[model samples]
Target chain A: MSTQWIAVIGTCAFAFILKFVGHSLPEKWLAHPRIGRINALIPIVLLTALVTINSVTVKTKIVIDHRMAGLGVAIIALYFKLPFPVIVLGAAVGSAIAYHFSH
Target chain B: MSVKRDSFSLSFAVGAYGTAFGAASATAHFSILQTCLLSLLTFSGASQFAVIGVVGAGGSALSAIATASLLGTRNALYGIRMAPILKVKGFKRIVAAQLTIDESTAIATAQDNEKDQITGFWHTGFGVFIFWNIFTLLGALGAQAIGNPSAWGLDAAVPAAFIALVWPRLVDKKTRLIAVGAIALSLVLVPFTPAGLPIITTSLLAIVVGWRA
Candidate 1:
């Protein structure tokens, strides 16, 4: 089989395992106080990883760039309690403008 | 309740990124069908990009798949959280599993109440699926029409979207400290690791910090 197909199969298997765990687990376990507390922390950690990883890039040498300017704008929007869509648009516009001006 | 609206919102939210992916697939000489199928089926942004990036950079297919698989490991954790809420049986569970992605899982888990969680998952997942596919097709069809994704600064959008998702929840000093420390660690390690490993490593570090603090 082609490697892409093999990858797809592996991904599908992984997805199945995830679904089995998510969909079939007992309610008692899911609602367990400890689980809830741990779940609460999941978002904070996941989002931190997501944001930080997406924001930075390495060129020939590592240098901080304007890519994170959008993240900054989004942070400001969130601080002001803007809606999610609005925050995204504002950040997109900010990043686009920053990219345009930086070059 | 509002499956159509949710689908629309998800598509609109994630469609641009999907389009970028489609464009990249095209640049890599992948067919439109392959691009669309990948977006529709794979659905995880980072993993898909990592796979494609590896291919575009002349890496072997095995390397690309390994990268995708490594990046996708987090979906297992998402599943662990979502298991109880889905409540499907047999065949339905399979379909639901296919639909679960980062945004839908996050929205569902973040909801304060049960009703909201169900709504959030259905709306977000349905929306992202429909829109992601549509934009993937659009991007593939108009690959040349779209400028370089990098030049358009689309790469910045992912972090911007994530910050929008995350920054609102930071209500305390400890969380902020963990976030700062995690970012610093991620930055330090990004150069030394593969594409997405830094995020995973930094997440583990943040979890440790959060556990201790």
Candidate 2:
């Protein structure tokens, strides 16, 4: 295998190892109030960051485009308690339409 | 119960998102086998994208690994939170750990009872795994047959799905405050930092908020 494949495999191993090691840690340690609370909140933080970065960044630069419109519509859909697929399709089709009009 | 329904829907939605990753890796010039392997073995969505993003930019495999590993670190954290509830042993532990990604951990924790949590964990973990891999092949073939995924706006699909996941969880003032903080911190850092770095840096805010909360 090439270096890229090696890296991919190694990274894959490292991920599983992290999961294994985490499971091995003493439950009492993670049970600490602060650690537990933060761990619970970590998903929110990570997902927020992921959504923001994905929506805004293109290459090395910050380019706001129809993706933002799609995100906006999706956020609105979320507030309205629209079912999941509608949210996904709304963003996809919404942005496609915005891109169609914009360009 | 509602939890199982949510788990099934969430897994299916996330599984369908493999189409985005397949198209993305294909667009980055990964061979069909490599794309499928990334989904199967690496299996984490953000890290897979990070690998493709880094490698696509002509970075070395080592650099790609480093970037992807940074994103994958959160799964370890998820594992930490889940280990108690999951409580697997030997080979079962390995299976549990492999399934211990963002979606599984989130859905499992959302449950009010331990039995339901375990059910949610397996349903989501395995469900996403099975569906995600199958759709990945479909996406790879589709990408090769068709043209640019971005032309069809498939690039936005993953984020769209992710937003739906995070939306329902923002249930209170404190959670909302921290999310707003994380997003603002991430956006401010976007211009100054590299592609994936801003996301990691936003964790600093999570830390501060978690500390103060």
Candidate 3:
């Protein structure tokens, strides 16, 4: 009913459209090495961009905060190869604790 | 673990993380209804997060749509990779498309044969879909009940969760370099560029790296 909801539906349809295009494309088209290579890199690149935006910038400003501390703890946890839940919730707990202490 | 077991567990764990999305969406001023609808319809975690992130920051609805649509493109790529393996027609194709996501594609690709690949894709995709929606509902209700999400530091959970998600995927020096380079580039561009533009720009780095590879 609202603009946001309309946009949401449009976004949902785009995924199907792109996918249908993919399905419709011949294997030869899909098999282009460049496409495959770029696809692989897409996730890697997007994830990095997300991590940066989430960690460093809030809206339009760059500010450092307890999230970085949690990230620090997470890097350590990741290095030791902790499980996913542990790492995720651990980072949250770590951030919450640091935020509490800092404020 | 067996592939089925792996699929189920992976779906359950990652799907439960929808709770974060529910919480984050709440923090971003989405209603319980809108939030659940987001999970149900958009169904992509990163893109959904981008929507809330953009809208929450006083961005235009167009910007939110642009950012989310860009991220959802990856799902299309996943769809291409899994389509032949899935080999469904008509209504089944719709199911295949819905299930065509990063985890399902990954799990399906891990299998050596067509049968196993199809099995992997269906199990993981539907598993995640079902669990993700359920948890999203629970999470939205919970976030509403909790009152202010920020005081509980649910705001930090997003970035922390993102860090947790990305850290494991940086498997080698090349990916690590791209990660580091993208981060630095985005940081530099953040102040000068619009909110959503920097993300699209980062794909340039991916293009260069991928071209060289």
Q: Pick the candidate with the highest DockQ.
A: 3
| Candidate 2 lDDT | 0.76
What digit string (tens of lDDT, one per residue) describes model 2 on residues B1-213? 888888899889889878767865776577888888888888898778767655553445775676567667778777888888988899999899889898999899988999999999999999999989988888788878877555666556556766776687799998898889878987887667655566656667767777777
lDDT of candidates 1 onward, in order? 0.63, 0.76, 0.75
RMSD of each: 5.3, 4.2, 2.6
Report how closely model 1 matches the true complex, as a DockQ value: 0.36
Candidate 3 regions off by >4 Å?
Answer: A1-7, B1-3, B57-59
**Residue B89 accuracy (lDDT) in model 2:** 94
Clash pairs, candidate 3, are: none
Model 1 deviation from native, Cα RMSD in Å: 5.3
Worst 10 residues of 2 chain B by lDDT: B51-60
- Cα-based lDDT at residue A70, candidate 1: 71
Which tens-of-lDDT digit does each residue in B1-213 have in candidate 3? Answer: 488999999899889988878877777678888888888777888777777766665455676677677667778777777777777888889777876777888899999988888889999999999999998888778778885554566666666666666676688898888888988887888888777567657878888988888
User: All candidates' TM-scores?
Assistant: 0.66, 0.76, 0.88
lDDT of 1 by residue, B1-213 (tens): 554465456557775666666665665456676676677677776666655554443335665565555555556556667767767677877767777788888778777788878778877877787877887788678765666655555555556655665576677886677678767876786667665455546546544554554
Interface RMSD after interface superposition, model 2: 3.7
For model 3, what is the error of residue B99's alpha carbon versus the real structure, in angstroms, after optimal superposition? 1.1
Deviation from native of the Cα of residue B49 in model 1, angstroms: 7.4
Off by over 4 Å in 1: A1-13, A31-38, A81-92, B1-35, B44-87, B100-128, B139-144, B209-213
